[model samples]
Target: MRLSIRSWVKRVTITGSILAISLVSIGCFYEQAARSRAIKDFPAPGKLVDIGGRQIHLNCQGRGTPLVVLEAGADTSGSALWQPVQEQVARFTRVCSYDRAGIMWSDPAKGQRNSHAIAEDLHKVLRAANEQPPYILAGASMGGPYVMTFTKYYRKEVAGMVLVDASHPDQTARLAQATGEPASNPIPMAFRALAAVAWTGLPRLVLPDAEVPELPSQTAKAITAYQPTSLAAAFAEAAVFEDSLREAGTFRTLGHLPLAVLSRGKPWSAFSEAERAAGGLTREQFNRAEAAWANMQAEEAGWSSNSTHQVLADSSHVMQLERPDAVIAAIRDVVVRATRANATP
Candidate 1:
C-alpha cells in the first residue's frame, strides 16, 4: 500500500519557539550560492537515488545477506554520521546508511515528516537502489521509532532488529512524570528558527563547527560544512516529532523476531548547574528521568519473545559514537541469529 506523496504530507507545521534572531546576516542568494559550493566541495560519499521525485542519499558498502540498514537520529545527523559503526558492520555484512528527506544530500521531504512517510521514503529509496531485503535494522535514538514503523509496515522484509537507547512511545509522558511537569522542549523551536534563517547564512555566522571528534577527520570536516545548511531537514523532523512518536507507539510487538535493545548507562540529561537552571530541570529530576528511561528500555526487550537487553554503563545517549563496539556486536549478533533462523527449514 503505497501512499501518495500528497497524502503523505497533508499538512506542514512548524509551530514552535525560536532562538531569538539577530539581523546580522547575509542575503539568501549569497548563502544559497555558498551552500551549493559547500555541497560540491564536500560531495556526497554515496549515491543519490531518486526516491519518488526527490533524491535520497544512500551509502552502501560490503557484501552479505540480510542487509543491514542504519537509521540515524532525526536531527542534523545524517548517514555520514554513522561512519564508525557502518565501517565495522560492512566488514561482516552488506550495510547501508541513508540521509532522510531534506538532510545532507537528500532532497527536502515531499510531505508530512511522520513515521509512515519516513518509512515509505526508505522503502522507495531501497527499491530504487535495488537493495534487496530481509533487512537488519539498527536504530539509535529517534531512529528506533523509524525502525519500528518500518517493521510495522514491512515486517516480512525484516529479519532482526537493534534499538540503541531508542525512544519509547510513552517517553514524553514517562519523563514528564519523572520531572514533575511536561517538557517544554526547546529543541524544536530552536531548530525551527534556525531553519528559517539558514538560507540567509545565519547558521554559518553564529553556529560553531560541528564537534564530532569520534568520527574520522575527513568525516568530521564534512559534518562541519554541512551542519549550517541542513537545518531544513532537522526542522522538518523536529516539527513532527510527537506525530512520529505516536505513530511508532502503535507498533508494539515484534513477535518471534530476533531483537537487541541497548540503553545508555549515564543520564541523558546530566546538565551542568547553569544548563539545568535554564531548562528548570534539577539534578534530582534528571535522576528520576534516567530511571524511567531505564525501565522503558527493559520493557522494550519484551517486544520480541527472543530478545536481549544490554546496559552500556560507560555510554551516553549517543551510543553509536560513544560505544560503537557494543553497537557493532549487537548488530552482528542479530545478523548471525537472523541467518541461523532463516536457515532453519
Candidate 2:
C-alpha cells in the first residue's frame, strides 16, 4: 500500500509540472504571434516623429488656420480614438491626433506617467512635427487634464479648448461619496491581470467587440491584437491617477480661453444592478447622484471666462464616437470664436 501511494504521488507531481510548462510555452507563443500580427496588419498610418530619442505617432489631416489638436482619453491610442471626429474637423481646419508615449505605435519612456509628463510629450511632438501652435485643443476623459496642463504651461500657443465628458480631479472622492464605496481604483489591478495572460492571447478571445465598436474594422483588430501593450500602458497611467488628479488641480482656470464643456446626458451606467440593489439605492437616490455629477461637469465650464456648457442630450461618455457631429460643431464654434478674436487685434 505504501509503495503504491508513493508511485501515485510522483505521477501527480510530474503531471502538474508538465501542465505548468505547457501553459507557459503557449503564452509565450501567443504573445509573439500577436505582436507579429499587429505589426504586419496595422502599421502606423501616420508619421512617426522622434521626440527626445523616442518615437511618437502623429496623424494629421485637413489644412487651415488655428490647427485642432485632439488628445484622447487615458490608455487610448489617440490617432485611432480621434478617427471619426478628426475626419470631420479636417474639413474646416487642420487637425492632428497623436499617440502618447508607450501607447500604440509610440515608443515607451521611463518616468512617472502623470498628466505633466503627457502634456510635455505632446508639446514636443507638436513642435517636432511642425504642427505650430494657436491650436484648438480638444480632450476627452483623462485627456482633459492633459490639455488643461498644456494650456496652463503653453497658454500663448492655445486659442481655444473643448472638454468631451472630461474627467475631474474630484471624481474619485465624489464617486466614493455617491456610491458609499471606498475610494480605490480597480482598473490597474484588472490591467495587471490582463497583462499577465495577454501573452496567452486571452484578451483577444475575451474582450467584447462593443468595447471599440466605433473603430474601423482593421483598426479595431489591430487594437485587439495589441492588448498587452495597451493594458501595460493603461496600468502605468492608472497607477498614478491620484497624482495626475492633483497635478490637474493646479490648472484652476482657463482665463478667457474659448472653452466648450460637453457633458454626457445619459445616466451613469458604470454601476451594476446588483451593486445598486445591495446599496439599497432607490431610483431617487440614483437620480440625485447623477444630478451631482452633472453639477460637477457644469462647474468645469465655469473655470473658463469665455466657456459654454452643453449637455449632449443624445450622447454617452464617448461623445466623440457616439455624437461626432456635436463634437465637430463644438470645435467649429470654438474655432470661429478664436478666429474672430484673432482678427480683432
Best by TM-score: 2
Give the clashing pairs for model 2: none
lDDT of candidate 2 over 166-258, digit per residue (tens): 988788788668766576554746557876676677666676542577878887776665656766666778888888888888886888889
Candidate 2 residue runs with Cα over 4 Å from true position: 1-4, 75-77, 188-190, 267-282
Candidate 1 CA-lDDT value: 0.86
Question: How does model 2 score by TM-score?
Answer: 0.90
The clash count of every prediction, one per candidate, is 2, 0
Q: What Cα-based lDDT does every candidate model obtain? A: 0.86, 0.83
lDDT of 1 by residue, 255-324 (tens): 9899999999964445457866676777788778789999999999999998999998888889899999
Q: RMSD for all candidates, in order, please.
A: 10.9, 2.8
Best by lDDT: 1
Residue 43 lDDT, candidate 2, scale 0-100: 92
